[model samples]
Target: MTIEGRHVVILSGGISHERDVSLRSGRRVSDALIKAGARVTVREPDEKLLPWLEQHFEDVDVVWPVLHGVSGENGALYSLLRALEVPYVGSRPTAAMLAWNKATSKALVKRAGIATPQSIVLPNDTFRELGAASVIDAISKGVDFPAVVKPVEGGSSQGVSFVNEKAEFSRAMVTAFTYSDGVLIEKKVTGTELMVGVLDFGEGPFAVPPVEVVPHSGVYDYAARYNAGETTFFAPARVSEAVLAEVSELAVKACQVIGLADVARVDFIVDESGKPWFIEADPIPGMTETSLVPLGIQAAGLEVSDVYARLAEHAAARGPRNTPATPNLVV
Candidate 1:
């Protein structure tokens, strides 16, 4: 299957916090698809976007949504796309919703026998009713020091904080709640941080080379993630071959457990003992200049344009979600 001359409408730049990142990702994807000879159109998910898509659906072949935050990853837009009978790249609606919430994805992966960090989910309403002092005290006692506090659902490390002591808990909670209605306090796993991208182009899913992330600030937050010089990345990661294999396998397993399709990225922390601990799974990973998935793709000796093109072709082959499938069709 080829995407040459096919029309690809990339949805990006929603009103989410990650709008800038989404635009960067969308531009990169559009350029890559165009390089593969596909006609590309970049559109923002605004008030008029749905009507525009509905009216121009026939002119579009596949929609590659590079949206990042709640507007994109929460599954609402994907559901509308499905309802409009439009084919798009990435995970399905249910899968996107499941993966959007960090706590839920961690629970699902853990249930699949994966090793995820122990954590507690506290909604803002519950935190308010429980009294700030009591909830903070309980969290400090329950989770070890140097814990990770983040919004229950978000990306780009926008509202993530690391608390090294009890006093920092209050500030961390405040920061997390700024981005989401809930917060997840997780035990910090110390070790090498690796991001593995799982991609499927018609065939079964497979893992790309793992990319090791080393941020100068000792944390891979929003600044380190988007700023090129703030962090150092090692494609294929600088770990033992055995550890690399384990990480790859775990990445694929995590995506499968979360029902992520087309393409996704699974993050892990490989402790000194060579055990990989699942951190979180990204349903729609950033395709910016400093993004890890692109590094992994290049490290695997594959061209980015080709991979994006193949994914678009695969989605187009599947056609609209509402279409009836042939008997014994391999999906």
Candidate 2:
């Protein structure tokens, strides 16, 4: 199967905090697909999206959703796409839902023997009922200091804060709650930050070269992530061959365990001991100019256009979800 001459609809620009990033990512993917000889259409996830898709379903060979944040990663949009029997380039709805919640994904990957930082999930209601100060005091006593506070479900590092002391915990929690109903307070693992992209091109999933993220501000927040020059990325990460191999394997394993298909990105924090601790998984990774996935792709001697196009071809070949292998065969 090939994406050549295929009509691909790229969904981007949802009503989320990451809308601008999503739009940039969608444009990048659109250009890549167009370069690969596919006809591309860029659309936002708006009120008329469903009706438009229904009207042009036959014309769309694949639906590549480049949406970030809850509008894309929480699995609601993917479920709707599935109901419409659309072939899409990304994880299944269930998988996406599992990966969207950092706490849930951490628990799952840890159970599978993947090392993840210890964390606690605190709902906004918990603070409202138990008292914010009381809850923060409890958390400070239970978890280690210098923790990472973030929304349980989000992307582009929005509403994420790094707290170096007990005093900062309260403010961090408040910022996190701004993006989600619940906040995940994780033990901030100190070391190199690496992002590996897992892609499946019909055969099996493989990890792209890991990209080492070094934020100029010492924090990979929303600005550091999307703004060029805010962070420096070292493709194929400056690590030993053995550590690089381990990170790659773990990236692929994390995605497989979470049931992510087509494309994904697994982040890790490697400590001084060289142990890689799983951070989180992105079911729909960013494809923007400064995104890690594209950097890894280029470092691996692969063209972004080829990789994106191949993903579309693979999704098209798989067809709609739950479709029987033999059309006439009765279950």
Candidate 3:
């Protein structure tokens, strides 16, 4: 459908560690909407963002939030958008919040019959109150080595660590706590790491071709994620046809189970047995040039601009879902 004359406010650049990344994504999204014949505004959310929404509420057709990290993916901004009754692209506030926290999202994904790695959630106070040494001792017994430690919420692989030994686990915990109060430590699933993007333009959600991530450092951290070149990505994931189909199916199922909307990028680690284990889901996946969503879009023979335009059109069609939101929307 033609999105001509559709007024879209592309919200990006929040006060988060991923601000730079979010701005780039917002610019790309704005350019795409403009190219698709829509009136676009690239906005950096600030104190005035809510007031601006209130004033121009009638003129705005959709708000495409590209904020990353805690500011964007945490769902606070989505709650505000809903309160303002402004249609926006991406998942609902509740879904976004649920998916924002890696621990909660993994639980839901597992509950949906998807295999996820064995993991544990630790709050900062657990370490402080129970004593760091005690907590570490418990973790050592619970999760196996060659584990992954990361903040419960945030993106771009920031504050993520690969712990090959118990001795190095403390540093990983400290790194994760630097980003968020809660940390998710998982027994690193051994297999092919794949990023599967799912989108529903208007029809029911389906998976785009999976993108396999191979980092030269052997760890896909923040540096490998944004610096480009440090990682080699395989568009069709170099997996067998059956594996590809299974990965795609799992991605779609995860989206449905998580209640994600418009689009979502589900990360997975496919074991040697060919089973795709869900790692996490991004309700607001990145849109930067080096981002995986664009790669998935290209692999599916679709352009970024077209996909984004379709999302905006769908948001306009549905309008905003009006509901009062509390401080916590996870439940």
Candidate 4:
């Protein structure tokens, strides 16, 4: 499956808060591509991304966009990739844009009849124009005290907070607003935190085994994400086979409904009722040492190198399918 001499660019490093982590992911992915024997180049994208690629896109066979959040995940770079006519490894421009914004994603998934926690989107100006009371009341009416507040467009749980008091709500909103223009307030479904990996291969998208995330302290934050031991991920999650099957099916449904292609990691919160609620869809996800996508792939007994090689092949040969994409191959 190796592309051999074909040049692949791993796009990373943006103006987002996750830039450092994205760079680390780019390094790891580049190393894997090198081991897989594909000529690899690492590119840090900004407004100059297009000009930079125009200089090299002709020689590039495909792009493995490792960028997370905003410009990278929201189709900014993917659009450029399309204009340049280089096949990229992750979700398409339109799909990535659709999935990156929390409000857009929630609406689409809810329309698909998936169980998402009660939530509301509030822009910073919306709060400024009105007041914090209205925003807090909106959250209070839908979600009770123990609530989750986060930036609508963020990664690695960068601006996420667990609020247990009304006094802390303002702080949480301010925190999230620093990362994004808007925030989403969701009812904290405290039970099991599971991440289901979805891989869209040549045949179609197949749901890989679920992974249970045990965060050391304040949930899965930036420090907990890249700091390794801060979080423990159990593959094939400890849930029963029936529950696993149900969760996997739901994960695949979420991916398809949101227009995601390539690979996606669907985050879910299983409530006391055993119902899985969609938290959000991670389009680019991550591939650093602390990332869960690579861990899930390895847990399936496939080498990381082989996964990258097959993924390269998948990227080179696959198409952006709104329907079933599980062509004839499975990764």
Candidate 1 stretches with Cα past 4 Å from truth are 322-331
Q: What TM-score, computed on C-alpha atoms, does each candidate reach?
A: 0.96, 0.96, 0.95, 0.92
User: What are the per-residue Cα lDDT tens digits for candidate 4 across 1-331?
Assistant: 4577778888889778788989998999899888888999887786666787778756877788888878688877767666677777877666777778887887788887888888878888888788888867666777776888999988889889999987789889989998999899887888888888788766778787888888888477788788968988788687778778888999988888876877888889887777888888998888889787887787777788777777777777653222233222111
Kindly state the number of residue pairs that clash in model 1: 0
Q: List the residue pairs that clash in candidate 1.
A: none
Q: What is the lDDT of residue 303 in candidate 1?
A: 99
Estimate, for each residue in 1-331, the C-alpha lDDT of model 3 and write its tens digit.
Answer: 4688889999999889999889888888888889989999888889988999899988989999998988888888888888888888878788888889888888877776888999999999999999998899899889998899999988889999998887888999999999999999999888999999999876788899999999999888877888869999999899999999998999988787777888889999999888888999998898887789889999999988888889899888877783222223232
Candidate 4, pairs of clashing residues: 202-327, 203-325, 203-326, 203-327, 203-328, 204-325, 204-326, 204-327
Tens digit of per-residue lDDT, candidate 2, span 250-279:
998888778888889999999999999999
List candidate 4 stretches off by more than 4 Å: 318-331
Between candidates 1 and 4, the one scoring higher on TM-score is: 1
Cα-based lDDT at residue 268, candidate 3: 93
Superposed model 3: Cα runs more than 4 Å off:
322-331
Candidate 1 has a TM-score of: 0.96
- What C-alpha lDDT do the candidate models reach, one value each? 0.91, 0.90, 0.87, 0.80
Worst 10 residues of 1 by lDDT: 322-331
Q: What residue pairs are clashing in model 3?
A: none
The TM-score, computed over Cα atoms with residue i paired to residue i, of candidate 3 is 0.95
Between candidates 2 and 3, name the one with more favorable TM-score: 2
Question: What is candidate 2's TM-score against the reference?
Answer: 0.96
